[model samples]
Target: MTGPALRPVSGVPQRWITVLGSGPLPGRPELVADADLVLGGRRNLDAAGVPADRALVLGPLAPALDAVAALAPASAPAPAPAPAPAPSDGASATTARVLVLASGDPGFFGIVRALAERFGPDALDVRPGTSSVAEAFARIGLPWDDAVVVSAHGRDPRTAFNACRSQRKTAVLTAPGAGPAEIGAALLAVPGIERRLVVATDLGTATERVEELTPAQAAARDWPGVQVVLCLAVADGAGGADGAVGPMRALAGPTEGPDGWALSEEAFEHRDSMVTKAEVRALALARLGPRLGTLVWDVGAGSGSVAIECARLGAAVVAVERTEDGVRRIRANARAHGVDVGVVHGSAPGALDGLPAPDAVFIGGGGADLPAVVTACAERALRTVVVTLAALDRVPDVRAALLAAGFTAEGVQLQAARLAPLPGGVSRLAAINPVFVLWGTRTAPGSIPVDSSATTAPSGDS
Candidate 1:
């Protein structure tokens, strides 16, 4: 009367999951067809012909990962009696089989990291495809080993934009709201930026499209479904006179920052000794904290030494100089250093109005409008403001302005004596004019303490 004797079942069988790259399954269609559970984008699930009951479309990542974690087998099953090939089609009806589809080389800024973090690396059998960055660079026949690559997907695009501005070549992985138009607009805002934009859409598919355009041209259009963007600096004749590719590079990414900073005044073209002294500049550069993807304003930029140095350190610089000769000097110095510095031919406080909000500001020569310039710079600078002054009288006013603007102000008087050759084959310390270097760091939210002790000299005082 009893039904056919039931075979004894052991523990829940172990599941085997294959994480496949974008496009077709690459001769593994049976994996999708026979999978007890399938996870991918809507397009991937449809293309793979996965049944509705078995398919789980990826949307909010948490829920998808939760589902995957929930379905994991509780324990390992007994081993087969003899050696056998791992299941290619699917696991047995009692065991769960998972197939995950992802775009591009998922390991490269893709879903693989999430999978590995959630399920452990040993749980995944990954099959990767070409990344969008590689595909975009390939379309232009350029080697990307020297290019900076950044992802703007589901994150801030500023870093990518800054990389594009600072580096000669950069690849940006695009997402909604941070695609070609946005990137184009950001680059267009930088006056005298020389860059070409390549927009690639729907990579690795039949409808893939790629186009090269100027930043202005790219900004003017509404790019839909952009997958990748390449920002390239206009060739600077690194190629031969016949326009051949330049010699291969030994390194990758953007060129390294200057070998030395706070360069000697002799390295720059300055009027008389009006340039910020190298000793003072050394402290000023440290307080300014200039780096890639930041904008720094050098107010009253005489000789553009600080501006050029900032550019050398990978910041986008705007040098504001009142005198025509000063502006010319800034440009010449920036050129000599082989870096880009936007020179504004106007006085500060007034000139600072039109420039983009700076991450840091260095007020080297504000003169009579020193207080006003400090106020203006303090209001707009995102992180810190540094002011160098020869007259001690202006220190109090600068500190007041910075305190009013919610900054933690600190100051130092630097006086260094350089080695001067003596008549007897000896050296003497020749005193340099003392200068006051004042820096103000923007206070974090809900924490604004105006330290009155900032005016006091630190430990060693003359």
Candidate 2:
């Protein structure tokens, strides 16, 4: 009547499967046994504090059935093996007893779910222990409820990375490959990621420790058996851990203004070959609308003026140029303007590859391949494409390039008048040659038109 095994009313013979209770004491339903089957504590049942007459002890998980077999009397026939655990499908019988061995707590992301699925949810019995994640958080003395928890095992690391990058606090469950080092490497590559703090190599019986490390340093470190990693940062990480806020600088608009752009020519210190004339740049930037949060690319960035202007307007910008001399000028210009403009010492389209896709692109030099770059940007659906062409013949190529790239292309011819000395007594408007401003917004229909409108026409910078 107090047998450990249970045999339903209908089955082949009266054979049954035995389930064992874990770790400590009895009266905890000790073990379930059949006529000749033993579990939990068999020969040494009494030593383990269970009555041998009724208790059957199966050994560890690997040889559980073998332990029961050796303890049974040779003359007794073995009971039918518990129906090869029900199929994984939920349709399996709802009532069954199964054994599961777990370190710490099986309920904490361990074998509990597997047991529940095989035996049916209602039949699951649990033996709990401290969860790994819990131990990890405790080891670091950090509260976990407010933390975003993610598993990096076999899952794309981006989900966990984004959680840590965007949230103020996050706990990452690491796998062998996606551990502290991998996560650290990615965070290091992100701009401004240095302001965040990291906790790596937590949990496990040995080598358990916690400390602060910059993402760059952490990613470069070699770590072993680290179960969890944590990332925490203030929402505005512009000020580093020491809390020093840096100077403010803009490249495109008045150094200070809201929705600030439409910058004046005097705002830039150009002596002035590298400067894109203010009036011409105005129209180019309108079509481009290079603003913060988005990314813009400027190729043939003479002084890096346009790219810096874009960066100042709030968008991340990168300038590409081939001349080492031009490269130096661009960097100097970008620094003078106090805006962070990435400079690439290479040519267009090709140099743009491998970089993050951009929101807009400006081709200030690729006159021959201007159409090709525009076509590629349009195919990728960049938000905008602006090209400044000075040669009379280059205008047709620029217009055709924009049109071929899925833009409702529009253009303008600008000429500016400069004050010239008239016999040293008066000043006269000296006519500057015309420059072509051809651009298009590679946008969906109903979007704002690419503004190629200009105030004055001049050759130097119309």
Candidate 3:
């Protein structure tokens, strides 16, 4: 399936093949060659439009696509599972002229990729419908082009929540457990974010409805038939777009990872207690490998140096600290650096719950029970853990906990000396105390990957 590229733009409509929901059929679906239409689910969509009897009723999808979970049309029998292609199901005359009926835009986290991943050139077609996501945004009357959209179907909900919480605007395609209710609750528990939750339930249906509430209010409400959610951050205006005046540019697009991290001391913001030393920050980031579509935590984010830097590298960070004053300092630092950080005002462990699950976590403070907190992060299977320690005594305990959790451990002791002018013209090197940085990447067995898709097809939300 991998080739020069899946050039949907260049392909002619007549030659392009795609499956779609009953609503908003593509121009090519009718404009192309005779297509075999399998009207499988609801019949509310008119059968009158099809060339008489040309439409085949494959029956209702009960167990077929679980989203089509309720009773199917009264007229049809139980639907059979649409068998995915076997190795024998190759691109030959036997598999010619294909089209499958999907409840929504199959490409919007549906069956289209099953086709795309398995099929080759001129072997696919697509006509997208207004997904549950598009419908959600439409109900709110908000322009969606500027929103960061994510899907929570068969995937962890944290990445989706983090995207919505950290960005000024976002739309999430929800699954049963990861729907509006769960997303709202997660955001509510976050320390530094304020959001207005909107859930568009049963969109484009008989009972279609929209509801708005505070994150807390939304969390406590009942949700049903909710297909999409827009959990927009309350105030980082003009909506994070291309060319926004921020250091977030490096993370805005796709890029490969860098090798050999532990950068020099000059790369960050510091005012004595202002930031994590750059050498340690680099080690932490390398272990974390924070990038687009990943969530990270910088517990006790003092100057927000690590958290802001992670945001710049394309991760959504939630910086948790105990003091209101510390929160202020982090926010100010975040603004100056041109990145987004959901700053929380609370101490560790106690404040950690309700926050979205992180792909990696960096703990710059907290305390002796810090090992216990790290243990909790491991329990959630956080992909990476990086802790900076000033006290040598705690290193052994931290190392033991990481090992117990099955993570390979590593540490670096970094010390930097700056040139300072003495009373006269002569300069003397002044050394800072060496600090030990402990870092661990979650092993394969511990963490799960996001349902990520990268397209060479130019940048469009769709």
**What are the lDDT figures for the candidates, one per model?**
0.76, 0.55, 0.62
What's the lDDT of the predicted structure labeled candidate 2? Answer: 0.55
Question: Which candidate number maximizes TM-score?
Answer: 1
Cα deviation of 254 in candidate 2 (Å)? 15
Clashes of 1: 0
Which prediction has the highest lDDT against the true structure? Answer: 1
What lDDT is reached at residue 107 by model 3? Answer: 68
Q: Show model 3 residue runs off by greater than 4 Å.
A: 1-18, 21-98, 103-108, 130-141, 205-207, 236-274, 335-340, 343-346, 349-356, 365-377, 417-430, 447-462
Q: lDDT of model 3 at residue 297?
A: 89
Candidate 1's TM-score: 0.83
Candidate 2 per-residue lDDT, tens place, 353-456, comes to 66545668887854677777767666543577787878877677777777776777888888988788988699999876567877787546322222231111
lDDT of 3 at 244: 20
* Candidates in order: C-alpha RMSD to true structure: 10.9, 18.7, 9.7
